[model samples]
Target: MPKLEPEIADEAPCSAEFTAYDEEHLVTYLRLLDAETDGADWREVARIVLRLDPAVDPDGARRCWESHLKRAKWMSGYGYRYFLKKPRGS
Candidate 1:
């Protein structure tokens, strides 16, 4: 796991929809998702996150969540990326 700077982390603008876990947490999650192991119950993860924020639309949140997991630096040799447009009416 890697410690990411705030700029490319969950602190980024909301449009990016980036979700970040701390280094230690990231490691454990990925280990549970390891190939040798049975797959994690991602639906539960999805359900929890969607419920965590009432503002989140399930479909959109799920997509953002999937994107975050793919290369959120939680998996071995992965990297974090943050990008988003400034919000409208700002």
Candidate 2:
């Protein structure tokens, strides 16, 4: 099945707690992690996964990619605990 791409923000939310935005972008985070694991270039990831063209907006794309990748790492490391602890069907 094809995944639906969500609109991205210029920067991902940076909160100590997992955020609603995080929940919405779970697939995106996973894709980012997978891309990193696969040794994909940041520019390619930005254009393909993030839907941002680095050539057109290098700084914006870089910022978005960096912030989201950071958040994605955080999600993999610590934020998964939040999902584990969350009550079902909230």
Candidate 3:
């Protein structure tokens, strides 16, 4: 799995435009969704998948997961349209 920057996870100001970073981290978003579906604990996901040490900064880790997960949901629901609208072979 591609590792996400801790800063991006911690303070994701989800942009309206689909960025290269978003494209790069697409798998991470998918994993987040799968974890949610499987009822996996956020704390565990943060530690294992997201590589966040919740014990060191519980609030920050939670915020990271929540924001990233929210962005992932938004991508699935609405942001994908941006991708579809792009010309092929960009």
Candidate 4:
């Protein structure tokens, strides 16, 4: 008897693009409201934004995250722990 396996093939690799993210960080903060499951876990988003400036006030960041998420579609239908799946787009 022989073992069978799924065939895999070599394909083109993806290359990262340098978009000068650091040199042109957005000074404006934004957020979106999650009416579906949560008022919006703005704190998590704020912490991520603070990577640009550790000195950034968390409360302020939460405000910004709220504003930004208000425009997000998923934000309106999810809770604090909700996160959009992509690639496989689960």
Candidate 5:
């Protein structure tokens, strides 16, 4: 039930660092996907889900949501292969 922290909100497009982070924050990514799928407002998602204030940092919040959402899509489409390669609890 861990939540995304404000400090590490911004996610990279792709990288070893981001891959590791994505694994740790998989739940957050899933939540993002769910929100997007449900057509939730990015502004609301930013404030409630991401614990960010779009009014204070609109660009940063938007970038954070978009980047994480993009990575989440990547996980669904291709990044799941990473988990397949390494068995869980290995």
Candidate 6:
């Protein structure tokens, strides 16, 4: 697994196009997807996957969680097409 960053943006980038940030955090998006599929608690996901402590900053943690998960779902549904279109070994 990739190293989890302790600091995260409060909101992920929301764009019609897949972003460099999206590519950089692809592992995180996948982990978020897996955690959701596994019925993991958001707070626990925040702690374990996102490296956030909900007990310390519930609102921030939730905001980051929701935004990232939304982006993750977008990747699963649509953004993957953009990835496929990228030239190999860019």
User: What stretches of model 4 exceed 4 Å from their correct place?
Assistant: 1-41, 49-55, 74-90
Model 5 misplaced regions, further than 4 Å = 1-7, 16-18
Error of 5 at 26 (Å): 0.8
RMSD of each: 10.6, 2.4, 2.9, 16.0, 2.9, 2.3
- Please name the candidate that would achieve the greatest lDDT relative to the true structure: 2
Worst 10 residues of 4 by lDDT: 6-15
Of the pair 1 and 2, which is ahead by TM-score? 2
Of the two candidates 2 and 6, the one with more favorable TM-score, higher being better, is: 2
Q: List the residue pairs that clash in candidate 2.
A: none
> Would you estimate the TM-scores of all the predictions?
0.35, 0.92, 0.81, 0.28, 0.80, 0.89
Best by TM-score: 2
Give all candidates' CA lDDT scores.
Answer: 0.38, 0.91, 0.78, 0.30, 0.74, 0.86
Candidate 3 residue pairs in backbone clash: none
Better of 2 and 4 by lDDT: 2
1-90 in candidate 2: lDDT tens per residue? 114588899999899898778887899999999999999999999999999999999999999999999999999999989877877776
Per-residue error for 15 in candidate 3, Å, reads: 1.6
Ranking by lDDT: 2, 6, 3, 5, 1, 4
Which 10 consecutive residues of model 5 have the lowest summed lDDT?
Answer: 1-10
User: What overall lDDT, based on C-alpha atoms, would model 6 receive against the true structure?
Assistant: 0.86
Tens-place lDDT per residue, model 3, 42-88, is: 99988876788999999999998998798889889987797788677
| TM-score, cand. 6 | 0.89
Candidate 3 TM-score versus the reference: 0.81
**Quick one: how many clashes does candidate 3 have?**
0
Better of 3 and 5 by lDDT: 3
Candidate 4 per-residue lDDT over residues 1-90, each given as its tens digit: 111221111211111321122112212111222222445344554444333222466555554444444423322334212222322222
